[model samples]
Target: MLGRKLNDRYEIQALVGEGATAAVYRGLDLRLQRTVGIKLLLPYVDSTTRQRFQREAFSAAQLNHPNIMGIYDVGEEKDQNFLIVEYVEGEPLYSFIPSPPQVVAEYGRQICLALDYAHQKNVIHRDIKPANIHITPSGQVKIMDFGLAITPDSKRLTAMGRIIGTPAYLSPEQAQGLKLDYRTDLYSLGIVLYELATGVLPFDADDIGVLLLQQVKKTPKPPSELAPEIPPALEAVILKALEKEPQNRFTTAGEMAAALQIVLDGGADTRTTIQPAAAEPESAPLSAPAEAPHTGPIRVVLADDHRILRTSLAMFLDVNDDINVVGEADNGDQALEVVRDQQPDVLLLDLNMPGLGGLDILPQLRSNWPDVKVLVLTGRDEDVYIMRALRAGAHGYVLKTIGEDALVQAVRDVAQGNLVLGHGVAERVVQGFVGRAEVTSNVLTTLEHAILTGIAAGQTNDEIAQRLKLDPQIVGEELIELLDRMGTASRTEAALIALRRGWVALEDLHNIS
Candidate 1:
């Protein structure tokens, strides 16, 4: 479509991406002499799809913030609806992971600011993922794609049968077909942050069903367990955001942003070395400066199950002037040993390590050495994992996918007692709690209750339907109807409420055939 002018103004340059509902194009606005992104709905989309598209455009148009991509116009030409948005020139935030602690903190701060602004406008970005977050050359972060966004007052366009956003980043309430609010977006953002910091998803399975089950039932491993160098304060912030119950998460995006800023301002009061009392000694004579001394190098330790990763990290740190790799370990147990012996300024840990898993060691490390900072460097970026890491006392979280510079910077910032988090983690932690609250109190249905019982008994929907001799679609529809009646936005929330009310049992549901 490049060079093709639409509506006598926009000159299509290239295809940026495509989805089931619409196609996004890179285009030049001849009138404004600036590049813009155009999202055009597929010409043949049904009325429902059209309505959703229009809603997305309208929701985005209501938001005006530096961290959010601006909507210039929404229009239709030749029966195709399209929206023009500010073109971000840089790469996605996902591409810049494992950034230095400072960079991670900065990115997180910006994302929180955007979220706060959007939430204040009563818009919830249901799709909060790396693909939707753009980072400009100047390091400014912009959130895009309100295509799956939902407003409190907005009408539900899709039928109960359809799932709205990506499953991997979905909140428990969303997965369960419950009503949503700003917290839903926060939960998704938490997953993004986890992924950005650790390069891994918190929950992984061979299939989507299993993944969703884990999302609703299992708890995440702490970030500190994965990366020992992360600070406890930072980890606390992440855990708070990832709380399975919305009431446990930050109440607003602004609150989350404020927490991140506090971390960045060195307000993280994490425990450091335990000092023992000693007798005062006579003061030594002062000496002149050998030369104007430079700041001390940022100390770090590398911990992973792979030997090659440790070696590579060590080699990489050797070349950086401000960073120094002081130790290496092959697993969580080994990491603990190294921490005890070397007490490095930062620890880069892996989540799925042998012997003691990263999550298993987080509490131990935090309890034993509160002063040492941890930076989780892993492959998982799920809300569960992000929450677990935060709970375990990680100070910073960066994914393996991050570049060398960002990783180096993250280490430095965490070592300096700053709470640095990758792009999506902070938002997720805050949203997790709020969304949970909304889903639990607002939505519930009879079919959902039946499914919850089946889930509690470890039964899949198919099995539940089979036991009742009902069609899977019927069961799904009934569940959706129940959720709607309960006023919850997502299925995950409905299940959680059911579980809490003893309407379902986790063991039963987990063991369902």
Candidate 2:
């Protein structure tokens, strides 16, 4: 299903993950020309389950807080139900456990703001554990997975007497299977804060039965007792939220967020703005840097999963007097931040980076920074992939095997608004131009024509060179130059022009007489 198009608008690119309820995909919205996350509910789910899923999705769609994952659309097509959501490029909060008090407060404040907004709308995120929260590289907290969210008017969708929510973060009322309200979320937030500051859950037991009992009956140690670095006022907020009675907890998420804000501001109400989670300059605010002033060099950002490749490329490009390597990234999300912040003249992107792939970010690059040319530097050789990148606004497609000279020239060409393609990629592009009836004559010189015929005949440059009694390097250089003269982007496109004009055919490749 990697290449399947759903509902004829959302094109599925790759499966991001799968769960018991649904399979999530990284997809493209053809109508909007944007990347989105598509969650496809399992077809076998009962009607009640589907209704509940829709209810939760539709309910969450109303929320517009920065910390909440935005829902875009939901629909069913030919028996397949799906929800299109904002594709957040981040890691689950659980991945960042054992965080420092300041960092916890920074993230916790965002979560509280989200909860405040959600609860004000009469929505209670029943599952408020670490796994339900995502932390962006920019340090923003986005709450996700509202599948079990309960509204004030929600009807029971579970078996009677059975509890829902993770036992580790469950409020005492939730553990008792009693009625729930907004205060229950604050209790869970306290558990999350406790875990964040102390690196351990407030109550822990291996047995589910024991865990639930502990959540209901046990008193938790103060967070300061374990972490010692936690300030007294912040610890008081945690203790208040951990109270067994709902009335004893903070009345609203806003109050709790205010308390954390005070701790972050050194016990003052300065309300110092929190910086985004992305790596920052030493002793500088994240927003302090505007676009780096152009200093007479073509700036470039490298986005690839391979560190060795990025380092080698950076080293090679650094020597070029005309080019400067401004930033490097290992994932698509980081790539976006780097490119946005640096505003480089060229973005050397790979196709399959983590979070967001090369293709997924092309539309964004086109929309947000159209002046910054995108040159896909990837190992993908398929014509389909190349066409997709080019159509999605990539200015160039170069393979990893590209020589330093060609790559450097491609960067310079793309920065000047010219399309560039490596030799092998050029051939694929030509092949894709097959079956067109319109013909142009004399696009190739006599020697270049012979070389194209030999290439169609499955002859390598060396083989063709020996047959033509010419130097292989000369043959290769002529082929590359011929592609430029013919105004074709790739070798395949050049080859297809020959094929479409009846200059070559599949039978010619092996028709030795």
Candidate 3:
């Protein structure tokens, strides 16, 4: 059919693309001397297929949008049926898959606007896939092929068990051959964006039968899991539009476009459920750097060995919308990797992890990723542990026993540069440092009591010995034995232990000094 003239005015130059129903050819309009795209129906198609082919021209002609392909003419001669359309220059949208979140959202917004315009005119482009969309060099999105389009009053031409659109992009209702509305187009658009953002389909199978069934039954993996770079906000919009029930999807294409707008505006964390924290704060975050303030939802990465607890925390925090669990880790090594890759604003770390314990990596995190604030969330409230973590550069300390609401608030507090201490942590710090005035020493020998009091009051062994009228060597030897017997690692730690365990009184230290 190359170099053939249709209707004596348009000359077909070459076949540009082919599909199951028709072939698109590069054509020249002799009357206007302009290049145009000519879509010709294959002669082998039955009458019903021919009617659908003619319907594409009529359906697409009704819509006028920069993102949509324009239909110019339609005719039939000598059993050849053809339509002329604006010749757009670019590869199919599929070629640009696995793009950055911004690129995906940009094209997605354009496609949504086009679909909304078509839907407003009562036309539903049932086939909304990457292959049916085009991207030009100038970055314009052109939606093509309204072959499977339908109007509210159009006839139902589908046969039972026969899927009308690409299985991978089909909405669950379309997969089940159920009646469709404009939302069906939204569902298909979701699949296209999911693929473009992640470079993979949400649902796919080798067999057509299995593929359609998967679309109806399989819940897709979240796009962010495949492409960690995808912003949480964009992923939320994609997943919402891919809902199994049409009613669960975005109510309109325009609404989905607005959601994408948030991601494009650099507020990649702004979501549907919760608004971003106010940029202007009543008080500046204590830990905020001097250069610029962080905006958007507080991006957090949780590192805990407890899978159930991690999942529960993720679900809880995600509901807030202003706090996204951008990344998660079940061990310390994974924590480091996630922080390096995700660069989250907050790292909720556990002290008792299996490998590379929290303390093991706390100082490393402090020096290597100083910008990321560390919050130790553990059950160890002992003063030794608290001081060690805080001294190791932790910004806050929260116990696992904290209420869910308090935990959320603690995260927000830490993000804003305020230090957080779990309910009893502060009291424990005080009790473990300042000896109880009324308590008397009873659990230690006289020499041990004197030495412990000296250590608590920040005195050295030589000073304790001189005050106690004992040899300096004797004080040193006794301290070594005490350290072993009490199972304490250092003099400071022993001091905290004596005070915390209520083994010594404040009066004991005054007697030695």
Candidate 4:
């Protein structure tokens, strides 16, 4: 369609891009003499497809935010329908990723504001990945492709089992085919920000099934491990938005924007690690750094292969006066050695160590150092691993994606002989025991998925009650019954089981708080 005139106004110059449903072109507004992007619904689509195509124009037209791509006109000529939008002069946001995290944060805040405006107008951008966002030369963010947008009042066009967004950036709810809202967009944007800071998507793999499952159950490593300079406050905001459950995420794009502003304003308290204890006057070497004093605080050890991760966690943990990181080891052999030497009260262990894997060493540790409460803290959140860890005598299992506060609590809880399960880990264990067919059958019921999702998110009966507009007492009793039926010991385990069976999704596990 190059050089072709449309509606006697837009003169197509060159093809910009082509997707499964439409093609974009650089065009000139004949009357106004300005550049524009003309997105045309490709020929051969049925009437329903054409209607959906026109819906994009209608959806974008209602949104008049600066960061949103502007829709100038929706027209048809010679049976070809098209949308005329403002031409952005730069590449997609993905091209500029691995950028300075602060820059990404600034851009993220703008994207949030734009989303807030659209969401308030009742528009949900079902597709909100990096490719759908454009970054102009002036560094302005322009959200594009409202093609997949669905208004709250609009009829549903997609089939029940069909997923409509990119898998890597998909929220757990989206992957699970649950109803969605503005938080879905925020979760995707969180992925974009994570990639920007860490130079990789949080959940990625060659297989779509693997990617989707990972999004539903697995948690990514902390960004600081990839980019050591990244501030904890910034990582916290990004991780919070990425929560599997929508309620666990920032309530609104505006709230997310404000949170980013705080990070930018240098409000994240990240002081980790205490000065080593002062040496005795006779034992002073005068050349070495001071060591942390052994003052009867909860003695702890960190075991992970990543140096930056160890340092970051140690620093974060050291900030608590009651917790002291007595030793750190990168591999399982080193971990065993350190644990044997220090005899720390608690051990934070990773599964995929080089010399000896966490699984390989767990039985040995249980047999030998039975007194030390081992808490599995790793990026792996699979049911098999979680169950294995528990069976091997681990006191707790926590994912790397867990919040700092949760990490602290897990250590203390496990040290006191209380079993602690990370946000997604418990749900997976629950699913394994319940079996898949039963879980799927339950999710097929209306709003049953919502209840299950609430559980997976670790919500209390009253919280789920308020969210679904049901009676708190009834919700509580029903959950108790579910536990009995599922043969789980507690609500948390039931939720985790539902998660493992894929009846409950990680996105629903809003463990951010």
Candidate 5:
């Protein structure tokens, strides 16, 4: 791929970056006789990731700013999809941690300006980390990778209950898979600033589960404690940005930039005072679980036939203060009894159990225990099983291959009344269903038809939500799941499907507006 010429123009020269979904390389534009950055999609990614890659181009192309990376073109040569961006010569921000307040504030102010520009244009950079930031030779900051950015009308990629963003930098809302706004980016930037002020992340753990919870509620040790040079004013700005609630934080990126600018103008750090938080633990928070403002931990009951698997999962969940594994049952009857007695907030049910089979008891549990959010765990990812579980009223479906953090979060999400699909369950089930829909004459619901038409008409999430008289956030989330089921790589694909299936009339699409 290093010497390949794409679109008969850009010739790949050298690979510079590689990630799970895409690889960025230095390329030469044969047409313009200039160097360009080419982000080529990796071959193994699914249609969803490919769509996201295209979405990055659409999302970022709307903004033109010095601090933001420039988008040149998006192309697809045969099966290879690639994005052309400005070739940046710089160092990543991760290498320069523990910088002084002046340097931190200076870099932060530039980031803030870029974010301000993007936010004004309705682009939310969901994944903001030090690695995504760069500093050129002359000290110009360049923010790269808009792959996770979201617009008001963009289709959300989290099919099922998948949460977005890096766990360490996730905002409370993002962690919970709730509606996000411009403030979410601000929260992530706050984390970057905090890490720059002190060499350590405010929240760090080998376990993703513990780290996610810390981001949501755990208060951080004062930056001054980690590095005594951070002034009171600078610390105040950083902490405010890290506020638990968006309402408590800066309303906009521009507002946060102004605060950072004040710190930059304050001259130099001339104080030498330290607080009691200097002795803070690296991972644990100062606030006790009992004293925290949030509600009690989510009560959960695990029901799996295998003892070892059930026991290990129980232990993993029980370790987190936000989750409690109240009981375990290895058989269907035992699960019924335990759930009846414990009345757990969530029931992690295994389908292949003895006596009353997991499938057999699903309807009974749904009828009797309406309050219990049932989540099915299975080793099989057959489409039939997923449909059966969900149709029987299970709130969440996950395979045994689910990661530790994802499993814990699934339980938490179910407890909060959210639907979850994990471990390729969504893509497999959605693809299977869509594949058979034409033959089976599977009818789409009215809302589903309307949404498909919205996409066909090229309307944004906000536009669709407005026309349907629903919340834009709800529409955005539903779009992600819908796209996954449609097996579409982009809006154009979704729109084409709707047109071919006759679910959306060519005229009706544009009629919405």
Candidate 6:
């Protein structure tokens, strides 16, 4: 649709994205002199796809949130249906990975904030993957593409046997073909977080079926196990978010944010200060035998439920010059027992192990031995998971997809009292905070009330200026000033804020005294 004009108003400038049911275009609004995004339904789409697209537009239009991409107009013309939305000039979260740790943490935080707001609005972004998350040049994170969203009162869009999201990010409940809720989105986000940290999928498989099976029936390694520098507290949070049972996961995104805040604030309960094991190793002599040098290699206890993957990782680490595999466990319970006996420098944990997942064992390990640095190794990477893991005291988060060099470096970093995060984990956390700022910007201003009232009374800015016997330039200047004062950098932003704050009450604004 690029180069095409719709209704002689919006001129399509370029094709931005193409999806299963629709295509997105960057279009110029001639009258408004601004760019906007237009989502046009594909001509050959099935009835179901059309229905879903329409439903998405309707549901999304109801939400007036700063963190959410705004829907401006929905209409059909010449046998084509389309939805007009705010055009965000930014890269997707997926594109920002591999940048830097602090960037990833910041971005992740913004995502969490956006999710929290959407949840409060009774909206579940069924597809919370990186592609749907936009990061503006100013470092604002806005969640877009609600095409697959599930509204609180709406019926399911997909048919009985069809899957909705990417295989790698599907929640266990989604993989199992069961009913879903807000927690399902959290699970997908967990995968995103994992990828951000480690730049790898938790469960890498050749086939979709295998990936789905793993998601539904198998446990994933903890983020810390893969990247040792992740604090134990952070690992606990990640594992908790990946919980198969919704009830076991955080009930609300706000609670997850609060927990993360506690971790970042260096509260006394920080995961790093876990109590030492009862049989603390005789403190290492401050000076090891200088001449005899440390004899054996650094020992590590590898724990994960997937035998093949666990064994593979263990073998890989053992090949390193300074590392030796001391023991392995298939579940959290076994991991604890092994740690009690082995007391290795590192513990590789999986989030989904049987009988108390890795997170459940973190506090136990801390209570028993506070000094042991725990790294999480998992496929679940989402802002929520990253925050939770950090709060729970994980030393670092590494995805299975990370290279051997980075994985090994993570272990060394943790052992040296440094915090480590996988490729995109840190950015997401920071973005979550940015998103909070954007949400706060949605608040209203006094001048906005006057402009909205005038518009509501069917008076153009020029006409209103005439009625008030004021210069049109002054009125327009006032409107611009109002937008600036309200923290809306653009006209669209001002309009959206006004609409959301109920300042533009078409009927009621005229009643203003």
Candidate number of the best TM-score: 5
Which wins on lDDT, candidate 1 or candidate 5? 5
What are the clash counts of all predictions, listed in order?
85, 15, 1, 15, 1, 87
RMSD after Cα superposition, model 3: 24.5
All candidates' lDDT scores?
Answer: 0.68, 0.75, 0.75, 0.73, 0.76, 0.66
Q: Which stretches of candidate 6 lie over 4 Å from their true place?
A: 98-101, 266-513
Per-residue lDDT of candidate 6, residues 1-513 (tens digit):
777888888888876555434667778889999878888876645566678888778768878776678888888879899888887765566655543333444555567777888888788888777767766656677777776788656777652223556667888776655677888887777777766665666776633344565776567798766776555655565677778788988888777766555545543322221221122222110111112222235678888999999888888888876678899999988998898899887787777677778766777787787666688888866444444455567766777777776677566545544456666654444443233223345433333456656655556788767765544655676666565556766666665656667667645554643
Each prediction's TM-score versus the true structure:
0.53, 0.52, 0.51, 0.53, 0.56, 0.50
Q: Which candidate comes out best when scored by lDDT?
A: 5
The Cα RMSD of model 1 versus the native structure comes to 20.2
State the displacement of the C-alpha of residue 158, model 3, in Å, after optimal TM-score superposition. Answer: 2.3
Per-residue CA lDDT of candidate 1, range 1-513, in tens? Answer: 678788989988887655434667888899989978888776644566677788878888899888888888988888888888887766666555554444555567788889888888888888787767766656677788776777877766543233456667778777666778788777777776665656666776533444555666668788777766656766666667777777778898888878777777874322222111222221111111112112366667888988987798889877876668888888888899999998877888887787777877888988998877878888776555665676578776667777665566566556655455665554454444334333545343344456777755656678888976555655665566456755786667767777777666666555554
Q: How good is model 1 by TM-score?
A: 0.53
Off by over 4 Å in 4: 159-161, 267-513
Worst 10 residues of 5 by lDDT: 282-291
Residues 1-513, candidate 2: write the lDDT tens digits. 788888889998976665434677888999999988888876644554677688768778879888898888898887988988888876667666777677788888889999999999889888788867876666778888777788867776652122455667888787666788899999999999899889889998643444565677678998988999888877888888899999988889999999888878884332243343344322110001122322356899999999998999999988887789999999889999999899999999998787788888889999999889898999877544665677677877888887776577677656755456666654454334321112356444456668888866667889888987654655786677566666875767777877888777667666631
Model 4, CA-based lDDT: 0.73
TM-score of 6: 0.50
| TM-score between model 5 and native | 0.56
Cα miss at 386, model 1 (Å)? 29
For residue 469, model 1's alpha carbon misses the true position, in angstroms, by 10
Ranking by lDDT: 5, 3, 2, 4, 1, 6
lDDT (C-alpha) at residue 328 in model 6: 95
